[model samples]
Target: MSSSVTPATLDYLAQRLDELAAQFPTSPDAVDLVTLTDDIGTLGHHLQHAIERAQERFTAPETVYPPERVALVRLARAAAGIARALDTLAEALTYATTGFQREAVEDLAHSPLRNDPEVLRIMTAEKYVAARARLRHTAAALRTASTPAGSSTPRTTGLQTQPAAGPQPRQPNRH
Candidate 1:
């Protein structure tokens, strides 16, 4: 099943690649493209693995939990996206040059999507959508986690709610 990507994961993946790129041997002396590519390669593989696991667990007929299934699906999508991005980075790295052979390349190696406008925009969009979906899941989880047992009142769930004061005896109506 196809899954949507999230910002947290994207941010996490991007950061990993950024860190790796820091190890590349570039003109600036401090640039580390080779290391970045290696790091991203590893991250991509792990993301692919995550997608596979999510596929197995979520797509299984035996699992009936809607929320969990959805979460897994989302995770799978995000993982797939990350994997693809990493692949793209790897390809880009192969032809990679430093010191203004390409302006886009410089941007990419610097900021969000390494500061390349197109890459940054794409990553931002993916991150926003994914983050929203994750927030929804987190909210749902919080609601479920907070739900009280055997109480119909909306205010009476979990440890957050104060215990009822005391049992009150019913009084008979007097004329």
Candidate 2:
């Protein structure tokens, strides 16, 4: 494979991950949390596919494959981690919503008034607030984990070296 092609492919994969990360809901509702979970799973699948493709590409002779493979594997792991985080967030939301509803109903049943719309509404709102906070915290943690450590410096993968800064003197074209 041409050197140019490998970096382009990696860039595409990185862009896709960025897009998925951006789609995470800042204030996720129950329905939104479910959708986000599914989306995160899908992103994980895509990352896995990328890793497989990178491995396959490695079979080509005399090509720089090890570094690319390492990078792809790292990305796949990050994607899986993010998906797990999203799953945790989804579970927390489901639990909060259901537990709150159950407790509210049970509490109301024991009271003189069996059904109070205002009380139910207040409980639901409180549940939503608490769940939203948990989701935001989980999302923040996922973002932190997904980012590569020491990202301030360019990563040196395998035998490839960074190109020197400034414009290169052009080589004369051979007739």
- Candidate 1, which ten residues in sequence have the lowest lDDT sum? 154-163
TM-score of each candidate structure, all chains considered together? 0.38, 0.39
- How many steric clashes between backbone atoms does each model show? 14, 0
Clashes of 1: 14
Model 1 lDDT tens row, 137-165:
43333223321234332121122111122
Candidate 2, residues 144-163, lDDT tens digits: the string is 43323443223323322222
Give the number of the best model, judged by lDDT: 2
lDDT of 2 at 52: 54
- Model 2 clash pairs are none
Worst 10 residues of 2 by lDDT: 166-175
Name the lDDT of candidate 2: 0.42
lDDT of each: 0.40, 0.42
